[model samples]
Target: MARPKILVVGAGFAGVECVRRLERELSASEAEIVLVTPFSYQLYLPLLPQVAAGVLTPQSVALSLRRSRRHRTRIIPGGAIGVDTAAKVCVIRDITGDTVAQRYDFLVLAPGSVTRTFDIPGLAEQGRGMKTLAEAVYIRDHVIAQLDLADASHDEAERASRLQFVVVGGGYAGTETAACLQRLTAGAVRRYPRLDPGEITWHLVDIAPRLMPELGERLGDVALGILRRRGIQVSLGVSVAEAGPEKVTLTDGRVLPCRTLIWTAGVAASPLVATLGTETARGRLVVRPDLTVPGVGGVFALGDAAAVPDLAKGGDAVCPPTAQHASRQGRRAAANVVAVLRGAPLRPYTHKDLGLVVDLGGKDAVSKPLGIELRGLPAQAVARGYHWSALRTNVAKIRVMTNWLLNAVAGDDFVRTGFLARRPATLRDAEFVDAYLTPEQVREHTASLRAGLDGPPTG
Candidate 1:
């Protein structure tokens, strides 16, 4: 029998888990598995705020897929541009600006997601996204820089603008970013004796009624209470209708001038999901209970990219795109694929909500696990322990824990790395966008500017 060719797109939680399972279930010569992504590392996105707050290093959250012991699978460093379902081929664009079409017998669409953006004026051009390691580093440096600028400025308006930080969306991402940064800023201000922590303002806005909608009512309220105690302005049923370089206009008819806007509204499935030419629910490919597309013979999908039924709810509802669901589904997708090869029965996808955890910096948290509610120090311990165990590598776990220990004993390193100027800090200008041109183009422009500024024809 000919060996089957399996192609998995993405290196996030789903793709990485699926690849590991495939390698374990199949023999070296039995099948060929290919993992395609823009980078060879899997990003632990949940701990991104810790990176931004200097509680963890950016590299600590990145796990290199190529270094794993799963030797049977080939790691392709590239992004899958377009999929030709009819031809069973994927158009891949690698890091070196080369494009190639590869064929597969079986395909797994798990490109994960991207930040969901809207048509709000100036948002696309001016807003910064907090989805990557670069963004986390930039935020860390930028926040410290803002404090320095504010302290040095004689103009009260400029100082006030520099100290104000606005965050959109009250979900896990936004809430965590705001809380962590607020704590960091408080610590950062002590170093700058000229600046006062009370002068800084952090605004968190959301259209939802609560801080964390996924964490249930009781826990959400507790989370909100914690933020309020920390002096974070938690505004519900509100949104930024317009965002400018200097300020944002809220839907409530309030205009706030601020230098920083950390956008974390939510995420949508990858644009590649739309190009798959399959039946999808809100951009997520619809899948059977066994996690396979009904009509596509050798196609399977899970994670944020697939709309798998939630049998645990006993209703016609789809499972949410959470890390909890994605991790389990990735394993199930691999099991079903292995079942097909070995002539065994496939199992349906189902899981009960294990509860939620919201870390509100400085030992304050809210959690509900197994239907039991927890708050304060207990919840904070549980939240940190959960994330530590969920990390992919022991090295990462140690590094993250070490940073936390050092931070508690000493304090945040307020010094900026000055790396922001060397690269594009915004999402649109970064390589995350599908615009043509390479990193070389970015470097060349910098060189041209330097040449022009050094006077005409130096003898």
Candidate 2:
């Protein structure tokens, strides 16, 4: 008799929550849990815009896996490249670059989502994503650098182009990104007296009809109003049709010459989902209400990577790929895994939409908590409080709170650390392109530097 090996993929909201619950509920003698992920920390993605705006430190958003007491579970520092269900094995490439096939009695697939990119000419190579902590930090540095370049430039055209910031998509990520960056540039401009704050334009464009549409109609209008009041030009029913080295053609028959384009369009399933060689709905593994892949023994899927049904909403539709739903589903999936071992009844995944919060930078936010729409500081309080409460680790929560407190009295530091220049890895390469570095090298090196690694070698 052997302990059932429970292998969980991903370290995002879903996977981390699942692993945490399993550690608490399951006895060490009953099961052997293995948590596999590319990184050793779980990222609090909702507050990523705060990281981008230099409002909160980057490390504050990442919770360490080592800090969590897994009890019996082993944390594997690797990603599952392929899953062989029939063989009951997962092909994982460890930190040492060795590919090992480990057999598992049960598997939880929460590989998470990747940036949903399009073939919209030069997007894949040029554009940046707002998914990871490194990406957020890179954006902050990049924005500051742009302001510096704008102030230093003599040519009016070059200066204008440098100051122009275009953000694509009207979703939560895009909206928050635009808001944060807009505020960052406005504050950063004070350091550059030469640069006119009015000249620095922030344009937000989305193909959808409204911004923050997921937050219901009233909240969407509230979010739009906040952005407009902040002088952010919101263009709905529009998209960047084409983007060149220094220009972008909008779908609304408008050509905007700009240097910076922050693409926060949307997310697709991870490449790992395709590698599973199983049936998927729009790159997501279609899973049952129990969070298991139908007819696929020993395989379970959840999170943005899996198409789990929203039984609460009814009628054949899968749940939205959100942290709110994914976190709870993770707990249920863990319980079901234990249920199979103990001959207990499995629970069906169902959750009522608890509304959404859109942080519109500064103290402006729109929220709908328990179906009640709220705006301004009230929304902002709820938004920040919710994220702070949900943040996984105590260290992260404390750091985030401290950062916020400091930011309130003292404004953002516009200074660029020039940290990424020392490292070859980039937001476009590692975080966006899905390129995992081989054994010896790490994908995100400057991450350590941003995490309070003291000044360079005192030579």
Candidate 3:
């Protein structure tokens, strides 16, 4: 008999962890583990700001999937465009645009998320995102290019627009992005001798009442103070009302001439969820405590795509789309999948909060591990130490550590790869945001193929 195919759609923290666990527990005869993702590497997303700041190379944070000792896992370099639950098939759009159906005995959906964008005028065309490795790398080059252009321009207006930068969001992602890149320009400006450092300004704004409300008042204030001390304007209760190539209008009635706007506002569940034709809570697919989608046998969902109930939090609360929760959910989901295979009772997922860490580049960090809040050098130490330990492989750990050391000692070469220089780095150009299907479309496609009317997969 053919082995049961265990298909996981995504290679993010959750999907990667789930596949790794399945490979460990199930033998070659038990199940075949198949992973679907556009990228071959599992991106360590938390340190993306460092990548943008020129403190770490892009490849350093991208953990490769083809690591040693995997017996049953097959990597599919594609994105799941739709899922046909009744047919137990997943339709995928490969890198070259061809489509195919992957049938599975068991399925895990962990497609992660896309950047949460808004209806602000010109934002999609003008604003940049900080969600992906490509975005991070592109931002670094783009920021440096601005410095180059500003230095060469004699016009004060052009210089001001070129020198000014803006970041929207007060969460860890946004705050750290603004803080790190501000540090990047603060230092890199010295190399461009003609450009006045005073002209370089970074504005961090959010619609929230305070910065990093997850850090509570104290540590959040500490982070806020550090940014202000370094000349970053921390403006809460405001966000980009409109964005254009040369200027930004704030909701608080402030107009700023800026060429760069990095939007780290938040993320929504991956579009894959919409194609499943299932219930969702604010964009995330609804899953039971056992990580199973209701009425979808042998299928599970986790990561940013699933609204897995927070058994720990209890009552209506669901797990937030965080790396910590996703990683834990992956392992538990693997176990549950094993139980389903053996006709055993499935176990529910539960985990306590492990606290938060914000690496504000260099020697600045804030951490609340095990309820102990820390800041400054102590926090930086804790933050890096946690990240170093969380790395899945020794190779990744070594690469990241070497990057930190080399960055601290030799400093950034401030070189741009220029591969993506010509490409516009906005959301519309950079992200595959359009590659999605409606539930009705998914049902139609899968049904047609199942009935042997399979023409070209795209048809």
* C-alpha TM-score for every candidate: 0.92, 0.91, 0.97
Candidate that scores best on lDDT: 3
Write candidate 3's Cα lDDT for 2-55 as tens digits.
888899998889998898889888888888888899898999999999999999
* lDDT comparing candidate 2 with the true structure: 0.82
**Model 1 agreement with the true structure over 285-340: per-residue lDDT tens digits:** 89998899877687888888788899999777998888888888888888888888
**lDDT at 371, model 2:** 87
Candidate 1: worst-modelled 10 consecutive residues by lDDT: 450-459
Measured over all alpha carbons after superposition, the RMSD of each candidate to the real structure, in angstroms, is 8.7, 8.0, 1.7
Q: Candidate 3 — worst ten consecutive residues by lDDT sum?
A: 450-459
Which residue pairs show backbone clashes in model 2? Answer: none
Candidate 2 has a TM-score of 0.91
Q: Give per-residue lDDT, candidate 1, residue 310.
A: 95
Q: Can you give the lDDT of residue 370 in candidate 2?
A: 87
Model 3 bad stretches (over 4 Å): 452-459
User: Candidate 2's residue-wise lDDT over 13-68, tens digit each?
Assistant: 89988998899888988888998887888998999998999999888988888886
Which prediction has more favorable lDDT, 1 or 2? 2
